[model samples]
Target: MRVRKIQLKTFKRFDDLTIDLGDEPRKIIVMVGPNGCGKSSVFDAFEEKQKDFRPWGGEDASFYSKAFFYTDETKKASTYNRNNSILIEFYPPNAQSSRKTFYIRTAYRFTSKLNVQTLSAMASIFETRDEPLSSIALDGRLDANYKRLLSASYSAFEAGDKTGNQVRAELIGSINVILEKILDIKISSLGNIMDRKGEFYFEKGNATNFPYSNLSAGEKEVVDIILDIIIKKNDYDNTVFCIDEPELHLNTSVQKKLLIEIEKLIPENCQLWVATHSIGFMKAAQDELKEKVQVLDFSEKDYFTGSHTITPIRTTRKNWQRIFKTALEDLTGLLSPRKIIYCEGRDQPRRDGTERGFDANVLNGIFSEKYPDVLFVSSGGNTELDQRSEIAISILSKVFDGLDILVLKDRDMASGKNTTAHDRDVYLKNNPSNHRVFVRWEIENYLFDKEVLKKYCNLNALTFDEASYDGFVVDIENQNIKDETGRIKNYCGIVSSINAEKFKQELAKVITPEMTVFAELESCIF
Candidate 1:
């Protein structure tokens, strides 16, 4: 089933939005936009329309569903429960069950474990419903998919007198075909069901007999979508297969291949709808499908007061530029950096609202003006940086040819060796030439240098207070407070409650060409 028209008013992030696909909509509808651009809300409208609707003390109307809208004027912003705001029109003009018309897979998709106690019957399409609106609702399909796979395989094996593996191959051979073609991997076996180890086993490269849980997040995503479609395609023949953020955890190359494979797997009568900011997927949909794909630029729509209509835009260079900006934002211009330094610490924020990528941010602030195109990334701790830096450099090199990537780490202060020339030589001899160690114990230690602190005090128009500063440094050295971040915070708390951001700014201001610390950093980074 294809959606011919959609009208939404006072929905999430949409005061009013309408999309009208004339008599025949394209086979594939790819909604491209930045995050929170009402793409997912459009899918929400479809799911909500299928719910069983019953107004207060009214009769049950299964085809009709309840939706929320602003009943108390646009200014008050008071939301009320109602069922009149959302309307979805099907091409066939017949009401179908939620499962029969719409097969939805939300963005948050993951399955940690699959332990099968007994085979469960698959829900009939007529009785099945759509997923909840919550994006964090995990896609618990792997376990159920496994049960269905086993049941189908067992039936085929018994009726046709086929071998266990052979019967299973018939059920999942198409899935394996796509997996092998895109990821260079295939399902080696469906582990023995009698032992309750019905998890999927895969074979890739030299690795064999690895459990389904061992697959990468991207690999698991591809497997989950392909397997589910293969098992349920017949039941949802004339359906609008909607996948929100299908490129989750997948790289650009994999996303392109996946889009092609998904289009092939969808039934001939069914239409595909996807909400994504994936450049690879969008490019593939346009270049490959051409007229068969409708590119709805959600980023261009007007989401203001009254009703507004939106139609597919031509995939022109201008249109593409806008989409790319929506997808990458500020990073669009820096897609290919002159140099990338993989340093220590996390790139993600901590739960307590602590700033992440501290090392990278500091380095960028110091060198941005001098080397404008150089990028600093916080890969992880020392060990993780050693491993992931190589992988990142390898993959990124393939994507952006001749990309200069390097690794940087802190000096090992656990040995109690002073920051001397001899120690620096020893560290360099043991590590790769591209992987350099800081002259200081860590990056933060540079901020607390006697000269840098004096410069900071002068810049802030405060007294030097050399006696107190020297005593604190001696105490820290005696106590062996290794965490330079904590040391900075402690000292700042005592003197003046300077936050990390302000501390970094003052530290950057003090790091000049005349300072010996500047010369040391230059030697290591350059």
Candidate 2:
């Protein structure tokens, strides 16, 4: 039900770019590039093209016939330029976008007069051209049909503690206070609390409110987006929101928050395409250890330990965001638990020696609809204890909300973290639950609270065998592995060789706010 692809031709630096929306899992698409490297140009190509597809603008131009790009030289405009031609192919995985994703072409001349006939030609693609603007529905419009003419036709505004121009760009001018949530920041304002009339105004030193006009140039960029979107609100209808260079004027943190939110705001049925040069924006979409961009992260050796990097888009041919679609999940309805099960790769050999496809049967029993998937739990997918443990903990926290759960943490036997039979017996006795190696704990009771762990200190922390942990390092002798050493040792390639059941045993030890440790997993037998 969502758009799955964006194809480009003759659009700026992307002489050609075809991006896949990843299979099964719907992921956030990130287009990365350096400034003036045509990242924004590619975005404009799509946005401008879509404009022509609309019946308005009275088309003197073919949506595909327009272009707006820098001249061949960095500082000079192209002296002998042609209307930049562009095409955007938007197709959804399901039957939803079948030939439905908007395609547009347009022509731009800052000095040219309006061409009604061209506009009419572009408009004809969506129903009859004779229809008036008020009467014509934008539901079927394509893009290039309008690309070049409306340079900044749309805008996004940002909210929260995010300041400066860049963060503000994410805010598509909304009068709604939801901005507070987007910025994750509190701004100073002098507004009155007018509850009855649904109004709030600026008052110095209030909750982080500022006048739109007074903000700096970068901050105004966000306001500009707000105004643009507000003026062209109708564009969202069956829209494909292609946002390029989202970090244009924002700080790293705000850039990330805004980018993260943009994916959520688009209508689930609507398509979203984004490109960025900032690593902050891509962090959520990229592999955690900088592991994905292995070669590029050569400068710092310590980045393996959750260190941050300012991602550089040095190569024009490389596509950074396009590669990480696997991590994308339409995080829009995160509050609702759409059942997902992350088990061991069904075919890959598991360290637990469990047979292939064993996870499927266990998962089927745990989530059967007759059982109504009441637990709405998931597998902590992987063969390694730590990665599996982390996956189990993360996905459950991110996706589940007040649901019963079953997490099958492998009883890792190869590592010291492995739960011995004695440890397993103790865990079983303490939690009093059983499902072979898999079991449940109520959300209220076992959501892995850091504060709780600090207080009670009863849960089994992830302790490695002193020898194995030491040998792993001593064996390497702090040699050339440098930056990659720590990460290589931590990834699933290494972890999967360890325990499968140890994780389950350890997770069973945490205490929930009210329920006993394993009550939820044990009660599922009914």
Candidate 3:
């Protein structure tokens, strides 16, 4: 199914806002936000627009309005917390006519009442309905006036030991299939899908001794994931998949594989949505779907009201053409294990102490100005890994398939120890270095003796250097400090000129103008 637009009025935090999703067919829609920004509210609001109209579980027709709209108009509080008129116009796939589903959760003027009444489950079609659809087929079909419940209808509870429709061995069978596909796990059969509310073996397979009560938390979550996928894929064309942290209890590999399956398996007639905080996991998933994917940044104004505007950040075709190659090469560079001449610091600051050097503010500086496709980021140090991951993933997901990231970390010049191996492994989840330098170190560290340093650990040179690149090698000198804090009181000597120049040169190889645009994504979290 596809949505035309969504209008929120007096929803929880929004006073009045409308979002025009435009005409897009069966495409995945990713909405990201900090916690409590009403991203889930958007999904919940969509549930209210279903044909059965029992999403909120209230008996009275007006009950949904009051509960889902802003509570007090004077205070500008709308129901569902987003507080904007929440309306969605949806068109089901395989439809011959221009039939659609529209839901509005806004206050309507009451002729006799003093206050306006909130409206929800306000679905309408272009052709007009003489009476609201009363009964729907539970076998997974809907009449014309009623649209299927996208979010509410799909849920996979923990496997309870039961054999009937509520919980069954079928769930375990399904889970085994997924585990086999993702984690390469294999077994004759698995424990049953249980009714967790009672914590009993609601369904037991004849071959199994007992239920999944003994299964590990990770295994249970594996079942949870498999069940959620099956339910969401039930009526693939009509399902509105709302997965909350599908990465829950999953390792990076499983997370990436599951995301890949969902992207490939979900029918093209339906849209898929996921909310997650895993940067590395997302990087892997984005790579799997690089050629066919779209991401929308909902980081701005999670709630909208009067003139409620959502800043659209769509990863488009232009974005792919712009940043894909550079990101890949950067990632490949990091995977290389040689003497990575990390260039850093000022290129002799201009009169303003910003124009000429490695000023991060200047998008067209060393990295971006120098590299068109490669992505080199000024991480400053190890503290920026999380923020850098987020920025890097968002940008690279738009351009390439995998994370194209190169983080230049400073290993004390005097000590001669390499931090590239340790730091790169922390983010990439795999040791990326065989030696101190990388395979692609030459691409960025041309001015510095990166090739020579890998062989000799003795040079780091850049613009305005007093000595050759050989003077800056980290390990050749074997200076000081791998203490508990890994610090040298006189770090003045380690943060020398040779290493700084190498840092800048490495940055100059990757970050391009397009990748720099991601720097302006208006991050709400670091």
Candidate 4:
């Protein structure tokens, strides 16, 4: 049922490779590697040689026949004896009829839009064709599975023992439980077969009676894998369940959840072997399963040159970083931020010609060249930032190890701080290190400093109209415009009525260390 050892020669993508699982293998084995790295070839070898390996049911002895596929035409001169295997004294050498040992689902798993006219008896699991490892063909099983479900209900109806809902509960209730938890939708009804409307319908929110085809590709994949496992558990109870790239079409978070749910459905006696390059799935295996899992890094050994053996790698930070490098390549840098500052603003841009993330964009524009690896994220208004920053930091810490996550708040009028920028600590007095507050009223207030705007005019060869700029600032302060953003917009309109966005951008561009506002802002941020 579980793999102890595997050997392959002249197999697809492998000339000679051996995978040893030691005396007692872990229940969950994750094969991690990049594309074209022989991960799928291991699955192919298992499929071709499955008949020679018998299920281990706590028997003192087990048997395995060596499997090989010669690539060169001349090498095929020697006939391969299918029944030949190295003999050990664990059990009787007399061979028994081959039994099912590997239950595999390839990466090309997909279901078409399905509708059934009549309920038919479902075929046994043994009767189903094992798809070749390379074929990209769709797996048309959802409709057939639906028929089997209806037939089970019809059989229970004829027996007159349980209601229709009860039969469904026995067949697909568990699958619905997982689906509801993941997608917030469940099977509303198995359509009426006699009415010539046999289809699987789903309900999400108040919407009801949607066909199977309406589901997203990721949703269908989730249902397909979980439903297949649930339906075949009785027949494939003690077999090695192999799913290749279970993360296909699913996002990172959903991939993690699906892997966990799939592990729950796999019988305790059976082992789960997953061949994947998904960070989410690998992370779930490492974090959630803990010591119960083993990760075989296929990227470590060069299988093409000659003979080689692979074993599970240690789950350390360095090894995980290498795995991420292999999996994501150049994209790995995007996720690895040395420092992150959460500031107050909305990051999303609206249809109107207004610039968003005024706080975050200004900080990034000013500090990006100085600290290239630091990231500034817009975390909404001050109140929302106060509520969500802690939870967000806790999560980011787990995702990116050793990341410096901090929060920066605006010094609004409510703070009752001195408006003059003489002696204000960037870090809050209550909590010094992680939580910081700006010295000015807000980011926009810093943008509107009279000295900063005068430098902007001087740099651009325009007239230094300090008198008009000061008049606008003085008028806004006299009006007591509490909203800093609206007050800045009014000042921009007075200066450049035609294009306030360009004016703000140009003024931010002119801000440098020469200006007092720039020095004050730099001192707080750095």
Candidate 5:
């Protein structure tokens, strides 16, 4: 079962938002927006809805009535209705069971504070059957739950109830997997409570143990999240998980890995929803979940009707790409490279036999060993490289003080009959310091040098004359390779069975230090 849709009217920042979550068994719904735009409010709305579905038994009120109770009063005057409400519908895999819908109007804070009341409440909730744990987990009140779990495990251990031991073992195993993958730390065992608090013991490569308290704040945060999930794993299946600001206290890499690990821990037939402000986390989520993830943007606005509305921008892949790209651009402080080089290529082979990274590899192969400070970014193709160069230079210039930026495009554009070497030279000269055109027809053409090809073919470079070079080009052209980029790749395969990347590496090693390309690059950099 998974959340099929959510409708909110006058609920906090959401004035009248209706989101349709497709009928997928499992999905990752990512709520993203600026501060106060209602990303967290999404989680708030979910918690409110969950409250109405009391497993312990509660008055069954109309869904609309429950939702209307939670409406934002500030908009009551402008909106036609004063009652605020939210509607949530779920899709169950089993058609025999009746459809479940929830209406909610109450909101509760998911805090992280560890207190006796919180512990007792979580303990009671955990022991209850079919009780949703998302409310507890989302509230940042997992510390109490963690303590209660440890206490229960201890009680079970003393009572010789192997069930408790089994649960602890599973939790420990899961935690270890997450820690090793995210933080590179492994827990040998979870230590018993000492001084009213339990701690995790880390196992060293040499078998020594250390206290979990010794872990950094970031490490503890990761551990806390993993522990929370493990403790509540039994309660998570077929439920909606709403996590607000999950990136808190974690670095970009950790934030990404944590979300991935959490997704893996979630049971099949369940949905994971996250509201976040971190672009790093969003990008990571997109990378990890791909098409399974939906990203919604929240922006606050005042309608001409004098009603305040928190609008949710349509969720689309292109929208997310633009959002992430813009976010990364704004976070220039995180950029590490002092110098930026934009080139036209990607590492993957294109239909044209040229890998999208061919140009990047060529540049990196030659310049990286000597100049490790420069960062080369591939722009996908020659035209894209040219287009992105100005944008990249303009953006990077503002971010990095006195940043050195260079854009390189293949000479392919000027290779046809109408364009001359002078035209290319003039273009290069006009852009002088930051722009350059390949001296050869293309980067691949340079790789087709007789010496490089001979090395792969196990033939002497001296054996390859101008006629051999012409014949090789003719052979490539005659093959009628579909992708222009793939032509060199196809030619290389025919001449030598060596892998393209390896061939490039070998060719790079053989390049003379005094090569014209090297001289040109040096002039541009220096």
Candidate 6:
């Protein structure tokens, strides 16, 4: 079974919200937005729905209690009608069967404790043998429950119960896999004495028997969540696992790795819903699950209403990578560059044997004093630059105001006086004023000016005759050095035995307003 849709009406902090999880089992739904934008509120709505939910063949309660309600407590004497409700639709795995719909209307209460009566109802629902389905909600209090359940399971396993032993074995195996892959440590054994608490002993090569309690807080948090899922795996089919703030107490790296690991623990029929503030987790999930993941941005602006809107940012399977890249860029402040210059290559040595600095560094070195607001970013390659331009433009247009974005490409092997004219026409028609291309074959070719080369050799105290250098340049041009990148490397090998990067730096220093490429760059930026 899978959640097909959820509709919230007058719910806490939500006037009207609908989330559509596509009709597919094993889907991962990710909720993202700024604080107070109703990310957690969506999870709360789901939890509310789960409280009184029963399977298809289960008995219904005559009376259901509501704890939380939407109300204005400050206006006690005033009259207002408040009806808060959540409606969720679920589709059974069988294709021929119709979808199952469930809903609940309740008051809004801000409390951490679970309702005892509701818990009893949930217990009864799970106890029913026919069509047993389970739901697990995880928040901040995972560590305490993790320890209690883990210790009890280990004790039962020690008592020689087959079921307890199976649970212990499964938990240990899963935990060890996570530890090894994420932390590079193996679990040699799970240790326990007659009256002593159980602990995990980690092994690394010759190093063995490190206690579980010795793990860092972040590691412990990861283990806790994974263990909680493992312990609860047997109780549910078509399960719904809701995790709010899964990144709690974890660093960026752990946040990413833990989410990837958690995905493995989810059963094939189970659906996972995550509410996260960490871009790291979002990015990691996107990479791991790809199109199986759905991200809803609750903070999107509704231009028609002139207020922030709650909706899933529509994306296709092919475009999800681009969407997440833009989101991650926004989260990390990469979009803060007022004037973004898209270019090829990242931190490769220039033709003049300069130290490794990609287009961004080269442009920065030359243009920073003139245009401090401009930020040059390497797109890793020319093709990537072209493919990602639309996504970058779309995301930047929404988040940035008065921003100037441009793309700079190399002429490559294509012949044209205006090297970037075709690309500008094809890709930059919307912002033609901001796009540019190097006059020469590539940025490396532009750095090979005779005057610049002569000056660079002299400054570095390298022995090179100006007449010989002029002859070498003429020969290279005569040979039609299309691969300027290779030619630069070869030129550096002949000119200086020292680092080629230093020569590129010297060339960058000598670059002046007279260079045609520099003039074009200046025009593109302004």
Q: Give lDDT per model, in order.
A: 0.72, 0.36, 0.39, 0.68, 0.57, 0.55
| Residue-pair clashes, model 1 | 2
Q: Return the TM-score for each candidate structure.
A: 0.58, 0.36, 0.44, 0.58, 0.51, 0.48
C-alpha RMSD of candidate 5: 15.3
Task: Encode model 1's per-residue lDDT on 131-184: one tens digit a residue.
Answer: 334444566776777777878887888887898777777766867888886797
> What's the CA error at residue 171 for candidate 3, in Å?
9.2
lDDT head-to-head 2 vs 4, winner: 4
Error of 2 at 193 (Å): 23
Ranking by lDDT: 1, 4, 5, 6, 3, 2
- For model 6, the stretches where C-alpha displacement exceeds 4 angstroms are 22-26, 53-84, 92-171, 185-189, 198-211, 302-311, 315-526
Which digits, one per residue and each the tens of the lDDT, describe model 6 over residues 271-379?
Answer: 7778777756775755556556777766454321222333454443223434444446444443244677778766355688443435666777777544544667776
Please identify model 5 stretches exceeding 4 Å from their true place: 23-26, 55-84, 92-140, 151-171, 193-197, 203-214, 299-322, 325-329, 332-526
Off by over 4 Å in 3: 51-84, 91-175, 184-187, 190-211, 301-306, 311-373, 376-526
Show the colliding residue pairs in model 4. Answer: 1-56
RMSD of each: 18.4, 19.3, 17.5, 18.8, 15.3, 18.6
For candidate 5, write residues 370-395 as lDDT tens digits: 45446677776666776777787778
The worst-scoring run of ten residues by lDDT in candidate 1 lies at: 54-63
Runs of candidate 2 exceeding 4 Å displacement? 1-3, 6-11, 14-16, 22-27, 33-38, 51-88, 92-176, 183-210, 230-235, 284-423, 427-526
lDDT of 3 by residue, 291-376 (tens): 44444445544354446565334343223322232224334333221111122334244677343424233223333322223333
